[model samples]
Target chain A: MADLRINLAGISSPNPFWLASAPPTNTGYQVQRAFEAGWGGAVWKTLGDPIINTSSRFAAVHFNGQRVAGFNNIELITDRPLEVNLKEIAETKKRFPNHAVVVSLMVEPKREKWHEIVKRVEAVGVDGLELNFGCPHGMAERGMGSASGQQPDLVEAQTMWVKEAAQTPVIVKLTPNITDITMTAIAAARGGADAISLINTINSLAGVDLDSWNTIPHVGGKGAHGGYCGPAVKPIALNMVAECARSPHIHIPISGIGGISNWKDAAEFMLMGATGVQICTAAMHHGFRIVEDMIDGLNNYLDDKGLASVSELIGKSVPRYSDWGDLDLNYQVVARIHEDNCIVCNKCHIACEDTSHQCIERLETSDGRSYLKVREEDCVGCNLCAIVCPVEDAITMVEIPSTELPMSWNQRQKAIGSMGQNEAPGAKEAV
Target chain B: MSDYGLFQEEKNRLDAYISRQFKIVGITENLSGATVELEHPGGGQAEVRLLTAEGRKYMSNLVIKQFTAAN
Candidate 1:
């Protein structure tokens, strides 16, 4: 078996999968159960001043027949007492001596409050501390959670305070509910954070009950915005991770969260620059046993790829991801319909005719059989026809080799700008 | 006419000037299209407007080629 062990910054885990500091990691019992069920590590839920939580605090967006395509929650940090959580953290760490036990913390933005919490949490012999500046709901209203996290200055100051007292590695979990997540990431780096994790969650509302004219998961007939996570937010989370990973300033091990559901998702995050991945929504949907499949699938994938260790996947694709202006303008692809595999459904023809460039044409064969063919010259290769085709191999987009030299939009513009205002020859003067 | 046909017509026009020993002197691009200026050594000059994406790309390639040859 390929070595699945990973050491993110200074926190070593048997595998790269750690349970995110969410509802799943709310208690020692749950976190211990997760570790027993094959989770490599767990970040205990955010600890600070305990508060009461509402009954209707969770909602899910079911896309088509898929249950919990996206999960949203207005839930606050650990409602249990600070002593109770600390005792459990100490006990859990003692029980699973080999497993990574990182404690997540959130409190008022005071320097003393941050220092005290960091010292208290580290005293329990935890592997690391994740500063929870990313819970985006009830706590944000009190100027905690995403409130202080939104301001780069506040994020930096709180991280500095925590670092002053923290003996263990400190990870600053970043909130995505901002214009740019890299701003907070850079701030955390400046504050001497040992590592960083993203993205906490995006501000979202699940949906509304059209019949009752009330919001989904409305408590006492009222609702507030919640933090969104789960499979549907994978693209958004992946992009943010990529953005931070590719940045030059924010150089820290990333504990990627937000919509990581399975081993494939974990591998993608790792490839995009996450040193490790944290799971919550998937475990919430299908219990803690899901980590078994994740572990098995990841091991099999690593072995098949001829890699001896899972850590080899980290930041492998970062060099391939780039800005749009760097793309070659002369590179082209066109839709090609395979007659043998086609079902003659005319979906491709209709999609091309109505929406995309009019390229795919219906033609009657010599034997009077109807078929679709793409006009290679006019087909812009938008992939609309291939997307709408019901049969998988019916339509394929093939690259057309360009005879001309490659030129990007940036290069073309630069060349044009260098020419600088040349008047057309033989043009009439203003007369 | 199809977009390809318009691009072919513009490409032919550009090639015709080159065949007549005309060298590209200037190019002006605006919302309308790209206007290419060409001058022959015998003191004759001509201008052509290219309105298609392919035609503009073709014009750019020629300009780059001219730059490479000069340098």
Candidate 2:
């Protein structure tokens, strides 16, 4: 069995599956129950000034036959008084000494306020601190949460204040509502953070009641846009993790968040350089029991791949994630139709004929026999034919070797620059 | 049309000499095969139904082939 244990910036856990700081980790009872259900750790829901939650705090969006594909919340951080939350954190840590207990905190972005909270939490012997700078809703209006996270300079300054007062490792939980997440990520690293977690949540209004013209998760008759999460936010979160992982400046370990719901999602994030992953919506929908399957599937996958440790998977795919300029322009592939495999489906022919390039040729023999053929020269290798083909393996994309040598746009630029004189030298000859 | 089997191998290659002899003007699908309209340098227009006995013979581009272009 592969070792699922990870030391995320000096914080130890039995596995990489941790409950994201949300309603699921709202209290000591919830955190202890999640740990009992096989979760390795929990970032206890954001703790700070107590706020009253509205009547309707959550709204979900369903598509087709699926439910809660996207979730939005008008909820604020732990509505419980801070002293009660702190006492609970201390009790939870004492009860589950083996599990990771990282407290999520968001307060006024004042130096003294951050210092006071960091000292108070670390005094309880919490494993680490996750600064919740990414909450996109309710609390943001008070000059905390995303208000402190969206600005790169504020993220850096606030992180610095926390670092000064923190005894344990500090992980800055980033907000995804920003224009460029990397700016904030690099800023956190520059502020001397121990690690980083993302993405807090996206600003969204789940939907509106057409009949009432009121926003979803409405308060009485009106509503305000809330922070969006769940499976819908996973892709956006994954991309942000990849962007940070690929950058040389942001060197801190990333705790991947957003729409992560299962082992595959966690694996993708780890491969993109996340030390571990946090889940909220999945646990919210199915309960913490889902972590059992996640742990089991991840172990099986690692052992099958012959990996000695799970940490080996982190950042494994970062080198391959690159800008479009580096891709080879000479690479080409053409579609080929298989005779035995085709189920007489003309879907591929029509797709290529009308929607895409007119590369597919339909032919008929005098004996009343007919089939299709691809004009390879005219094929742009768009894979439209393969996508539309109903039969398995009916259409295959076959690679054609580049007639010339490999030369990317980046290389072309360098070769042009080396010429010294601006004669606009042909890249094929120059290289 | 489900009458003929697709060319399964590299045999699907276009014949260089035969392809150069006539330029394909247009192709339309019908009962027997794809009706290919070709234009010769002599300003002559001819239609050949491909994926058939005669069409297969012309595609070979190797054998001593004869073509009777339908006016």
Query: Which candidate should be chosen as best, given DockQ against the real structure?
Result: 1
- Tens digits of lDDT, candidate 2, A332-422: 7999999888876789889988899788999887998778999886787899999988788989999999754555556544443332313
Instruction: Name the regions of candidate 1 deviating beyond 4 angstroms.
Output: A421-431
Clashing pairs in 1: none
Q: Each candidate's DockQ score against the native complex?
A: 0.47, 0.02
lDDT of 1 at A157: 93
State the C-alpha lDDT per candidate.
0.91, 0.83
Minimal lDDT window, size 10, model 1 chain A: A422-431
Writing each residue's lDDT as its tens digit, candidate 1 over A212-287 gives 9889889989999999999988999899999999999978899999899999999999999999999999999999
